[model samples]
Target: MAKLVQFDRLGGPEVLTLRDVEVRAPGAGEVRIRVDAIGLNRAEIMYREGSYFDRPVFPSMLGYEAAGVVEAVGEGVDGLAEGDPVAVVPAFLQSAYGTYGDHVVVPAAAVVPRPAGIGPVPAAAVWMAYITAYGPLVEAGQVRPGDHVLITAASSSVGLAAIQTARHIGAIPIATTRGAAKRQRLLDAGAAHVIVTDDEDLPARVKEITGGAGVRLAFDPVAGPGVEAIAQGIAPGGTLVVYGALDPRPTPLPNAHSYPALTSRTYTLFEITKDPERLRRAVAFVNAGLASGSFTPVVDRTFDLGDIVEAHRYMQAGDQVGKIVVTVTHDAASD
Candidate 1:
């Protein structure tokens, strides 16, 4: 039997419950992993709250990131063996294969070897955040050295990853947060500049920071009326990649009334992860960054598997500065 989290009704974090169930062995092209850590994401919360892009089925399991050791591999699986340390990427739909469990069977393509020295907790936090950021900044936006990039909601795991990723490429990352509490932390986390949205005007401040030139690239997850402000701060020919819907309201595009020629597009991490060539390039790039010490996963807090409810509450509070991870334990020990 394996322990996993599931919820029949949607509404809040309280809906999540831990239960024991039989975990079937991996089938063809599948890999079963003894999950040691699970990463928390906003998408999970949105899914639980009935606000996600995909509607949930009753008694649904929802998760996308985890790190563990491979326990078995099915037919056609190659390059992986029992006892190998691996991390699951957020390549598939959460409804299809959730990772919030002690053991899970996932498509082999979603599994990647965990880099040496990156333990389960950090490993669980890596792919989703970095890849989400990478899709917009490096792959699509083509951010380059010295390019000024604006990152909104800059304290979330993905936002912080954008900061690190921009720094790795020699780009200037200007981070934005809802309040002043996270300003220093965002700066400490490598943001070239921090903007506290509550006090300052986003468009005005960004324009001032860029000497009226505006940023070369703007990465935003929150869309709504606020997106127009972000669009106003982007340079002509610059790109604003919207990857999420933190703001539930309808997002407004740049109006024709004296607006700059800013290009805006909706992007999802799947755009890169779903394509074989793009996924290969993304994985190789991230691996190189990790090997060279240019990229590091930041963990805000960790909770034991039993404390998942409290962890979700904390995430909903929106005060976290980085990734929240849940650790799992087994009675038997292995080398």
Candidate 2:
């Protein structure tokens, strides 16, 4: 048997329960992984709270990303073997193959070979955050040299990824958070400028940062009544790509009288599934960045599988500077 996380009903972090489950062998086209680490994401929290795009069935499994060694490979699987290190991508349905367990079975296609020199914690942390940021900034926005990109929720793993990605492409990344505490952290994380939203006027600061022309793109995850303020900061013909809803309030439409002819768009990583070429490009870009040390996965804290509820609570507290990870132990001898 292996330990796993599950929830019988929708609610908060308290709903998550750790339980022992039987380990089943992988079937056709599936691989069984002995999970070493799991990446905690806000998507899982939303799914647990019944606010995600997909609703959970009763007693549902809930996770998307993990890193581990392959224990076994099913029939017709190729290029993978037992004892190989791999990372599970967020491409599968959570209801079908959740990774918050000591042992998980997922489609072979969803497994990527762990990059060289990266530990299990970083392997679990890289895919979701980087890929989510990559789709909007690199693919859709086509961010170019000298572009000014605004990143909201600058302390999130995805937000940090955007900062690094923009810098990698020779663009100026402006990071925004709710207070001054994360200001220096964002600057150290590769942001050209940091905006404290609670104390600063967003549009005015953005205009000053760009010398009155305004930013070329705004990557926002917190879409609420303040969206119009973000819209006002965009340069004419610039785009605002929103990928999450951290705010509970409804997203208000941009003011019609606003200048700059801004375009508002919604993006999700799911689009990569429909376009294999884009996924290929994104993976190549991220892998290159990882190998060169241009992109680093920042893990704020790690918890044992037994402390998952506490991990969730910490994630919900909104104080973490980066990703939160949960390490799994299959045997008492392992740390």
For 1-335, candidate 1 gives per-residue lDDT tens digits of 88889999888999999988788999999999999999999999999998888778867888999999999999999999999999999888877789998989998989999988889999999999999989889988889998999999999999989999999999999999988988999999999899999999999999999999999999999988888889888998898888889888998877667568878899888887778789889888888888898889999999998888998999999889999999998767421
**lDDT by candidate, in order shown:** 0.91, 0.90
Estimate TM-scores for all models. Answer: 0.97, 0.96
lDDT of 2 by residue, 55-165 (tens): 898688989889999999999999899999999888877767799989989888788889999999999999889999888788888989999999999899999999989
lDDT (0-100) at residue 212 of candidate 2?
92
RMSD of 1: 1.5
Give the TM-score (vs. native) of candidate 1: 0.97
* Best-fitting candidate, scored by lDDT: 1
CA error at residue 12 for candidate 1, angstroms? 0.7
Instruction: Compute the lDDT of residue 281 as modeled in candidate 2.
Output: 82
